[model samples]
Target: MASTNAPIYDELFNVLFVIGTILFIGMTALVIYSLIQFRRKPGEEGDGLPIEDNLPLEIFWTAVPAVVILFVGLYSYDIYDRMGGMQILSNDMHSHHSISSQEKVWGGIGSSKQESNTSRDFPINVELTAMQFAFLFNYPKGEIISGELHVPVGQPITMRMESKDVIHAFWVPEFRLKQDVIPGQPTILNFTPTRTGRYPIICAELCGPYHGGMRSTVVVEEPEEYDAWFKKNSKQTEVEL
Candidate 1:
């Protein structure tokens, strides 16, 4: 896992896999047992028994599924809450006065409830725009624009993203973070990259005929390296401006 959030998702997946495997094996065993124990006799082919309703069996089956589903629902909800999925968007998102012309605020995976209680520095904010076949990243602080994303390791990153034309998705599998970029609605994605390496950024949603080509790279680097890169890029941006 390259990010802190990946383990939470992986744990959820593991739990689901274990539950599914147990159910599959148990059901297969029951089928095999029924075939052997309740099959027709060698030469006697008559209506053996007329069983109306097995009340206990019915209750067992229904209760088992219900309990299992309830457990899953609660478990999934907890995971989502931990990932900060329960953080609702602001009510004024649709109001034109609340946001600037260049950006519209939409809620997404933010800091978890637990994280919200702790005192921490603000995350590095970057604006991203997804077009038909490209992802553009802009660092508002430095007035720098880049085709690829660059960030320091071990720090929180908040991506404010939107789509220029159609719906697209920003997905970084290693970090276990994905968010849709809707044309008129901006969204945010928060994560702390723990590994210092290059990771692929893919558009998980199909937006256009060339959706497959909408790809970019996120370069996670040491704090010093990132600072140097940022300074260099910002200077160039200044010259261009």
Candidate 2:
């Protein structure tokens, strides 16, 4: 499935991969050149000229990696912030402001109605409960489904997840989204699927003996199709319950 976050992840991967490949090739060439040029030939080696370190060479090596790391760090942080990693900090700031201003925070404490409404515009909210070897999804309208998550294409989806027993991870590789499901601490993942298809959901964390079995499917469909499926499933769930 095409995802909103897929391009960001792909760009980051391409940057890192290019940098790594260049570094590896350069280092290998340097090693080979040094070995061939400084070989012990004709008794011309006396402790390798006392091995004096050059300040320029030392500075170059140190500064290059430092700069590269700084750039990558800032770039990754931008991506993380865009993916809602900074929501926690935003919550804290809102909390502080609410206390200081003596004004009730709209939509409840640690909640931003503006931000929520913006991100959740026509979005489907799904609650994911992680257990030993399975995932259960609950829709906002009280429909529950096991082993499958259904969302409408071209609309936003917010998954609020929590673990029942231990820590688990919700990962959909095709969507380039993953979030930890911690016990007693809820987490949210917001994404909009651009394509309509069935994709796999994987548990990336080692939660239990059957962690390998923690797998499910996400079905993205058109709005009308999704509505029909949801209504039919809701009725079936009501009948079963």
Q: Which candidate should be chosen as best, given TM-score against the real structure?
A: 1
Candidate 1: stretches off by over 4 Å: 89-104, 113-121, 236-241
For each candidate, what TM-score against the reference? 0.85, 0.81
Give lDDT per model, in order. 0.81, 0.72
Worst ten in a row by lDDT for model 2: 105-114
Model 1 misses residue 241 by how many Å?
A: 20
Relative to the unseen true structure, what is the C-alpha lDDT of residue 131 in candidate 1, on a scale of 0 to 100? Answer: 96
